[model samples]
Target: MYTLAIDLGGTKLSAALIGEKHDITQRRELPTPASASPQSLEYALAELTGHYQGKAHRVAVASTGIIANGVLTALNPDNLGGLNHFPLQACLEKLTGLPCLVLNDAQAAAWAEYCLLSDRFRHVTFITVSTGVGGGSVIAGRLLTGPHHFAGHIGHIQADPHGPICGCGRTGCVEAIASGRAIAAGAKHDLRGKDARAIFARAEQGHLQARQLIARSAEAIAQLSASLKALLDTECIVLGGSIGLAPGYREQVEELLTRLPPAFHLPVYPARYRHDAGLMGAALWCEYCAT
Candidate 1:
């Protein structure tokens, strides 16, 4: 049976058909609606799912934010344009006419990555540093979603007590400093209004300020990695998302991780599924649950 996998992110929406073998096809993408209205997301989802009428037997979604009881509550409202409390699973079921399964995007990715590393590590943590920072962990060969389905939100952890306010109304969160949104928000003068990607390009050109901005993000992630190791005793860390997989970002994080004590040192590998980890993981979860 084919599973319709959807990845909902701050910047884009993607849907694909995943075969039982875990191969993906007919993938489609659209920019996320910039509007905060619920109707915008509904329409966008309808349009996205409309492309495939009978392509799959079940729907699986890996979405940003907290997914509890078939609903999505955005911790950082800015990430999803202020959309919160959206009925993600119910809406998708109605659109696709198939039972839906939804989970935190990063959590879903963590499961996919863990499956790949099952033979090597019993404990693995996956972190994504894109629009916002997020994380999921596989501990003792099981994915940890916690009781409230909010276990792996590493981005909300405080990196600096006096740092800038997060969109979630918290102060000094990792998301406020290390996320792509944070990187863009931190820009000034020449880099003002530039997105993270543009700043990264400039950084590659030897722009000192651009390099500093990215370095700040890397620093936060490194600290977060160390904290995860301390808390979870994860055997390894898998870094994902656009910023995590960037040319030098992982190297920077590895270097910073080296600054910690030997106990905190763990190998940091790039996400093998890359950007599709969320989608693939969601599909894998669907298959796992459906059977």
Candidate 2:
């Protein structure tokens, strides 16, 4: 049976048809509705999935938010705006007329990376530094979704108590410092109002301010990686998302981590599935749950 896999991210909504072998087909994307009202999101989802009607047996969703009891709550209001306490799973099932499974996007990506690297390592962590910084962990070859489904929310972890306030109403969270949004938010002068991608492009052209901004993000990520190593002894870290996968981003993170103690330094790898990690991961997870 095929699966309709959806990745609902802060900036975009992507859907795909996944065959039994997990190959994605008929993939499509739409800009996530600027309005965060439930109706707006529902309408967007309808349009996104309309083309694949009657093409799948089950539905899988990986979304950017805290998913609890099939509901989605945006921890950072900046990233998801008014999309709070949304009934994601029920909405998908209602739209698709099929059984559905839902999970945090980073969590789903973690599962996908873990599945790819499980033979080599039993403990792995996946970090996505997109509009926000998010993470998921697999320990002893098992994904940890936590009792409250908030297991790998490493982004909200405090990075600097004296830094700027995060959208989650906290101060100096990794997300507040390392996220693509954060990078853009921190821009100033000539760099003001530029998105993370543009900022990175400027950095590549040797803009000093751009370089510093990216380095700041990379440093926050490196510190977060060390914190994970200390807490979970993760064998490796898998990095993805727009900022995380930028041309030299991984190398920059690795370089910063090297300055720390050896114990905090672990292998960092790029996400194998890249942009499709969440989609394939959600599909694979649904299949695994069925068995």
Candidate 3:
């Protein structure tokens, strides 16, 4: 069986036809519309669904927004143009006549990595430290979905009480200090209009400011990883996303992790499946929901 998976990200909407083996047979992508008005976003998704109408048996979506009781609360209300309390699952299912599963983007990515690694590791934590920090976990082979389906909101965990504000309006959250956005913000003065890629490049070239920014980011992630180790004792932590893939970042994170008390020791590694993890995971969730 095949499933159509849609990943609705902050800046892009990607759709793919994934087979039972987790291979993406076909895909489509478009810039996310400026206004996330229910009507406009729904129309964009519908257009993508129409392209795959009879090609897939089911559909699943991994949305960048928060999902509480199957409703969507876009992270940045201003950029999303205020899409609060929208029944995304119902709307998408109504738009396309097919069974649908809606999952938070991080949850879907975690599930994808879990499906790939659960046979080898019983417990796993999946973290994405990209544009924004987010995480999810599977403990003892079961996905961790809290009462409100917000289990892995590690980004919101307080990292600095006096740090910059987060999109969620929280102060000093991990994301506010260590996310890609945060890294760029901290380096903006020295970056001189450079992007995160440029900042990383400068860091690679030994630029003091860039190097410091990267180290600070790694420290924030290490602190969070230590907390997770203490709480769940996960067998392995899978790091994904753009920043997570950067060279030396994982090593730096490991170095910082070692500074913690010897008791909090768990392996930190890059996700085995990186780029398409979200889409594959959304497809896998469809199978899980079916069962």
Instruction: Name the top TM-score candidate.
Output: 3
Clash count (model 2, backbone only) = 0
Q: What TM-score would every model get versus the actual structure?
A: 0.92, 0.94, 0.95
Residues 54-136 of candidate 3 have per-residue lDDT tens digits of 88887888887678767887555663565677787898788778888888889889988888787689889999999889989
Report clash pairs, candidate 3. Answer: none
RMSD of every candidate to native, in Å, equals 2.0, 1.6, 1.6
lDDT of 2 at 127: 95
> Local error of candidate 1 at 41, Å?
3.0
Candidate 3, run of 10 with poorest lDDT = 74-83
Model 2, 87-190: lDDT tens per residue?
A: 99999889989999999989999999999998899999999998888889999988899999999999999999998898889899999999998999999999
In order, what lDDT does every prediction score?
Answer: 0.91, 0.92, 0.84
- The pairs that clash in candidate 2 are none
Better of 1 and 3 by TM-score: 3
Off by over 4 Å in 2: 77-82
- In the range 1-291, model 1's lDDT, one tens digit per residue, is 888899998778999999978999999999988885788999999999998888788899999889999898866555555578889999989888888999999999999999899999999999999878888999998889999998998899999999999877889999999999999999999999999999999999999999999999999999999999999999999999889998999999999999989999999999999878889999998887766
Best by lDDT: 2
Rank ordering of all candidates by TM-score, starting from the highest: 3, 2, 1
